[model samples]
Target: MTKTSAVFPQPAPGSKPTPRVYTDEQKSMIEELRQYALSLLLPETDSYHPNERRWIEEPECPARYMRAAKWKLDDGKRRIKGTIEWRREYKPDLISAEHVKIENDSGKILLNGFDYDGRPIITMRVGRQNTQPSERQILHLIFCLERAIDYMPEGQDSMLILVDYKSATLKSNPSISTALKVLHILQDHYVERLGRAIVTNLPMLLNFFFKGIGPFLDPVTREKMKFNPNLHELIPDEHLEVDFGGKFDYEFDPDSYWEQICRHAGVNADGSRFEPEWKRTQMPQQEQEESPKPVDSETSSTAPDLVADDDDVESSRAPSVQLPRASKPVSVKGGSSGKEGVEVIGEEEPNVLVASA
Candidate 1:
């Protein structure tokens, strides 16, 4: 198997690098688990996602599963078996771009850039979440995960997560059940796939949301989470966005980004799925309107309770993390380029999702 540069956060200058070493017994366990995985007769399906198949057969996969299962042979086998079953039932590979355009267009989650370690980065703008929590929302996240894996360089089995809480209010957070489902998918199905997680600009009240999901977080995954990390240390300045204190100047262009991601996923801007020779078509349009006025980040205060009980939903609806809107107007790049150009409003700005869901 191919190998990348020394594991990231390269050893401190003048310090000895402690490369990972597996004991002979651990190696044997991994070998046994690998054989067990290969011995399974998977149910015949129309097709499998390349990554899913890769996760089963790759040389590094067994070790990853064993690591996730804490080097227990039987537990590793069970984890692998469970993930295979989940993938078969979920068919995450079949999720179409048109089906998730609303969530994608919201720019709530994006797969972009790479960390210093070459792991693809997934940036989740919690503040931009506009839809109610639902299965589709989970699918959008899974879709992004599949795409992030696609971007992973060979020999690299993990990806980085950046949760941007800028302008996230208690109302913007997903329901607890939805968050738990997301955690279940990530921890149980996507074993050993998180390199690190950096949650930035989180508001004080959002702490409630984190606390709700805390118990369910895998120990390894929880340890990977870093609150308010210095972005420059993990991501190169060129790839890091200005919003996150890097030299890279990026404004989220919803239409262009959506179409680009759709095409990459073998689908058109419309709901049509196509193969190699598919032609690009014009995206549909609807009435467009400006979003609500921006809230001043420095002055706006966080809400009281982020994870309110169902009966206290009204109080939980208050906004939390507020970010100052961009001062200058930026041009919209895709279908609605005809507009005089909307001011870069708050996270609530509507860059319309044109596909019929």
Candidate 2:
């Protein structure tokens, strides 16, 4: 038997086996499962119409399915296996979930909380639930006015509409003052644009300027005046009969309306009386002498007497001290004449030693 090289061809070293391809039926099943998982995560909104439903529902369907479905192939085998391990690892952090829950709760509480005085903190509540505006709301309005005035079109006047249905309800609220201050600031800051305008339906404006008599029929005067109603009742076709187009509506007098408002409100139009200028009164000669004189530059230049008086007071207040005199040296009897010579004296008797020159 001729020993022909009967060598079985060894598989190529380090070569990866071909991956197994999923059958169409298996692939379809896996896709359906993935879609089911996605549906569980995101619920469909009921806002869509029948025709629009398909587009809205399937908008993120592909991405959702792709994220949800995960599979792995066994080493060089065509068998496809679904992974539940990844799903177990995909749990959302408990802390994150808790944080979201807490945030939502706190937001709800803040929106609905009341002060010690039983007043709502936030002003922008639905409907007439909270008619009175809070300090925050007033501040918000001020900021809005500033932005509006900055960007308003030229010649087209800007108007701020403050709609308050319940004037009587907010009568006792302290926030009313804050609201008024905001209005005053807006009016004063935009004085150049004063004619530009502020259109408000709040009965408080009429109450404030018209002496609180126009909105309701005056029981004492028996005068009936129209007032603001609900928004739904306001007809778009309706127009205010007053000729607001006129430059001066009442009597063609400049500042007529403002003057009238001030009059009705019992306020001085000139504001001089409200903030009067202080006047100086002439003092008696004796009183003037008694009062301390202010040291001006003229008085300071000729105050030599004052300077001499200060110097005398300083010298008198100083402690007394005796300084050694440098005028003369004491002469010692029979003292040494040479510079290097030394002399000794007894304690009891005066004795002197002299060096020969």
Q: Score each candidate by Cα lDDT.
A: 0.56, 0.22
What is candidate 2's lDDT per residue for 1-357, written digit by digit as tens?
Answer: 121111111111221122224567646554554444434342333221221223214332222223223322121011111112111121110011111211111111111111111111121211122223322233223322332332222222222122223332333222333433433343223222221111223344334433332223112111111222221111111111012211111122213222322222122321111111111122233211111121221223321111100001222122211221222222211101000111111121111110000
Residue pairs with backbone atoms closer than 3 Å in model 2 (clashes): 20-78
* TM-score per candidate, chains pooled: 0.67, 0.21
lDDT of 2: 0.22
Candidate 1: stretches off by over 4 Å: 1-25, 43-54, 262-357
